[model samples]
Target: MSDLRATFERDGFLVIPDFASSEACEELRDAALRLVEETDLESLGSTFDAGGQRHGHDPWFLGSGGEVRAFLEPERDGDRLRVNKLGHALHDRVPLFDRFSRDPRLAALVAELGLAAPLLLQSMVIFKHPRVGGAVPAHQDATYLSTDPSTVLGLWFALEDATVDNGCLELLPGGHRLGLRSRYRRDGDRTWTDTLSDEPWPSDGWRAIEARTGTLVAFHGLLPHRSRANRSSRPRCAYTLHVIDGEAEYEDDNWLQRPPTMPLRGFV
Candidate 1:
């Protein structure tokens, strides 16, 4: 295995080429497509984590069936409903998803990087549809995943080619040194707000992470990264697995804290 620790430390993100086999990529892509076709749009409100705690569903594209179709193209008669993403915690939905999320390679990297035992808490299949894919604003993963010392990492696996035209990821070099820029906290019973930093984004330091299928892009939680809307005809699809250091106490005030349903899974 390549020594990713040095590169990851230098840039705050490292793109490992051919990190997964072709068969693995194809299997994951097929599984994601199947889920998109079968998932119920209305039942998203009750999505659950592996621990069986309630987690809200992130919006999906629900695309039209065509070689090159917009995310929201309505002919009114009928369509093959496609989904854009499956998230907050989708690992336990199937054996495939669960296994992939906790792949041994991921855990090894976490250990090599000198991080504590890994605790995977969330997973996602982000689909950037052909035309109407929306842009994800520049932000740190720490805003959504708040840990005490903030030792979370994001592992993004490309299911297809990711390019600038298809909204490939753009990351700031060594941005993790700045730490978290936004904080999400509950106000009272139901309200929550994100307090973002007043400092301007380092747009000049941004660089595109154009990856091929089966590539893995591992980024630090505090790294500032973003992706634009997919304007090209090709769809951009990927799986995002978010992991955090398991050695710390997950605070009660953190917005994303979920009740433990089972023991945290780790790898050697």
Candidate 2:
């Protein structure tokens, strides 16, 4: 754990291989598939971007969203409900997901890192569906999660092997020091204008952080990263959870908004 902590602090990310049990990974994978079958993607509203492309917000945009999700097929990028990513927060809505979010191992890791009382801020399931999967534009997590000092962490658990061919996460080392380059979120009915920073992603030092099934990866909140389209035969599934320092001041206009009556859950 000390080595992992050092690597994360130095590089802005760390991948811990074979951290979870195969049984646990399979259970979460099964739960995700069930969610896909049970959800109605169209119920979530869609808005057009400046380029006239229909962009669908995460399940948080629609109060009833997050049960399941899909990505728009870039080839036929229209109003399609093609599945890709699962959510901004599922623990608040799903029993199985809620359990997954509170994994003791993750809690221990946060404590070891010396983070202030870790709070569950967001949870998501991202899919790199084969062939028609789309590329995620390079971005920073803090773009959506706006904390005053911006102390946040991201945990990505690989439910399946994520290979370079299947759109594994690629990151730029120490990118968090760039201090958040953009802010993309909903402003109104047709808001797609995103703010940018002078600091741009380095054109080099990018490497894929592939993981086998049951592995976990940790990254800094402001790290700049993205993934490619999965052209491989099988799809890759990953479970992602985001945490914030409980003592930090979280901005009110974050893209993922919590209800006024809701409280952040303690992890460690």
Candidate 3:
């Protein structure tokens, strides 16, 4: 973890090799694929890519806006389960927030953050589909997290091999030092947005941090980052785990109306 710690502190992001194991990634990916395939929406919300193309968010469930989940599974609501649940259930009922949770790596990561009684704030899978057009405009995650910068970490676990050719992640070195920046809606994508910090970084200095299947990238909550479209004929599926310094709150009221799963315990 030393190398990861250094990279994270220096560049605001770090990629750990083979952190989760390919079998684990394959299991989760299979589950997600099955869920997407079996999804039968009653009132299916239109899925658009960041570029506003039809079926752009295709082959993946992109949750956005209010209580309506972007996609629905035919027989089960498991597809609506956030990425945090995936981490928890993957550990066999451990809530991922609990310090005593069974996953050693997660426990170590939580410790590394020096969190005291930290809260498992939010977890969601970001599925980047092949042929999905448009870039995820560079931005700081804190725009959506609403937490103290140092207390939160975004754990991006790759479910499939991610490469620059397939729109892997890119980051601006030391950008987290600038803290949270103003956010703005992109011209087309409603599910996500761009950040004002993108303009300040040296364009040539940006680096694509690619990783293998099972690789894990942990980054500061406020790190300015973005990903390109998956031009390859494969999907880039990933799960994001978020941990905050204290009990977290669901600032968005819409989640209250969604189908109940596990309760998000923290500040109400």
How would you order the candidates by TM-score, starting with the best? Answer: 2, 1, 3
Q: What tens-digit string does per-residue lDDT give for candidate 2 at 34-129?
A: 877776756534322212335534343433223333333434324445566666567666777788778788888887766777888888777666
By lDDT, the candidates rank as: 2, 1, 3
TM-score of each model, paired residue for residue: 0.81, 0.85, 0.69
Q: On residues 199-229, what C-alpha lDDT tens digit does candidate 1 reach at each position? A: 8787698999999999999999999999887
Query: Which residue pairs show collisions in model 1?
Result: 61-84
**Colliding residue pairs in candidate 3:** 83-123, 83-124, 84-123
Report the lDDT of model 1 for residue 125: 76
- Model 1: number of backbone collisions: 1
**Residue 5 of candidate 2: its Cα lDDT?**
78
> In candidate 3, what residue range of length 10 has the lowest lDDT sum?
82-91
Off by over 4 Å in 2: 41-81, 185-196
The candidate maximizing lDDT is 2
